[model samples]
Target: MSSNGSVVPRVTTRTLQKMRDNDDPITMLTAYDYPMARLLDQAGVDVLLVGDSMGMVVQGHDTTLPVTMDQMIYHAEMVGRATDRAMVVVDLPFPEGQIGIERSIEAGVRVLKDTRCHAVKLEGGAEQADRIAAMVTAGIPVMAHVGLRPQNIHVDGGYRLQRDTDRLVADARAAEQAGAFAVLIECVPSSVAAAITDAVKVPTIGIGAGSAVSGQVLVTHDILGLTTGYTPKFTRNFAEIGKAIGQAAADYVAQVKSGGFPSKSESFS
Candidate 1:
């Protein structure tokens, strides 16, 4: 219990390791600011990611790349302040992770110091394994992203899945070997996702990688049905809060128009 007599919230590396050891699924959702972060923490989300996806969800950017390190830090800090129990992980935006080992450490430290996130997630595979190693060695827990890397949208030619099993397995192993605590597999076949999880020691968290992986992660807006503008094939809508909210507002307007709302007893006298 806390000083306020509420149940204190806490998460640690041991908790994450227990999840991996028990094959217990990890739940992660992105939050850009305070209110959402607090709500997610209260709702028992295992991890709260300050993903660069915020560029699209909050800033209206077409891609996550256009977001700057400073912008990431600012949002991360906000989310961190609201987080008491959930493990906070912040994304090292596009080019922020591309500039080799030393730069990666610098970037990781800058973000970590600013936001106090439990770890930092970055996109890479065997090709960038050395950088991942360097970041890990520098005490930054890394969450590797494979398959459809949104930061490389131009090169991947629009978020396609990896069709080659051999390559995917190799990349997963590389990430694990490079000291990542977990890997995020995006837009890969379910069979391939299963194979990768079996091949690696670290937990595999899937976005579009299907149900075969160890755990699942979704952008808060995407899964909560808040995003009405677009939808992805792999994303499942558990609740359509957006539509419900719209309908509720419409109903309120109708009630007012018909003078059915704010009945005499309820009116401010």
Candidate 2:
């Protein structure tokens, strides 16, 4: 049973594969802290990613490049500790896994050992096949990210939609062949995402990549309307939680100023 007191099966890499095989959609959400991880897990989210996007969402950085391995490990540890069933996967922060095969393997090993996360996710496609293969060979389960990789935000100029059908399909196939248990496709057209999903044997998790893929992921803040500043085109605020929080705070302030908060029964004395 999970923290919610329900007997849902614990989600794992094999669970994700089974979902794909059975044509069941996988649900993923990004979580960086203990409270959020606990909530999402209890709500039965299948996977919780401690994504490097924490650089932007949590640390107030412009891009994910500034996130470090130490920061990732710290956050991953919190999420892993809080989660009872949802599989936790931490990102290999920029330049960590991209450097070399040995470095990549070392980073993956450290993430799994230190955080006790189920797996690690890395960005790149065919070019990253060697690193993915090496990590899997070393016993690290890898989830590959292709299409609009946020790690390449600077190089790509911005979060533009990926349209190259042949390349996207090839990347997905190569990652699967390289032993990645699943692949994440980001910011691509639905047609292209669908093709790639068909091309790969493993599950394809999409973010801004449309509905034809096997699964979907979104940053929790983005979906909850908690994100400030600019919101992405692909994001939909499922709940106005930020507004509700602000309204609650405003109500509390008004009650305190009017001396209406601690009257009669509200007093402990």
**Model 2 spans > 4 angstroms off:** 3-8, 261-268
TM-score of each: 0.89, 0.94
Could you tell me the lDDT of residue 101 within candidate 2?
90
Error of 1 at 125 (Å): 1.0
Q: What is candidate 2's lDDT per residue for 1-269, written digit by digit as tens?
A: 65457776678888999999999999999999999999999888999999999999899998999999999999999999998889999999999978879998999998889986989999999999999999999999999999999899889988799999999888888899999999999999999999999888899999998999999999999999999999888889999999999999999999999999978898877
For residues 213-269, write the lDDT of model 1, one tens digit per residue.
Answer: 777888888877888587888888888888899999999999999999989988987
Worst 10 residues of 1 by lDDT: 1-10
Model 2 scores a C-alpha lDDT of: 0.92
Residue 66, candidate 1: Cα error in Å is 0.9
Clashing residue pairs, backbone N/CA/C < 3 A, model 2: none
Output the number of the TM-score-best candidate.
2
- State, as a TM-score between 0 and 1, how close model 1 is to the true structure: 0.89
Per-residue lDDT for 158 in model 1? Answer: 83
Q: How many residue pairs clash in each candidate?
A: 0, 0
Stretches off by above 4 angstroms in model 1 are 1-9, 248-269
Q: Report how far off residue 1 is in candidate 1 (Å).
A: 6.0
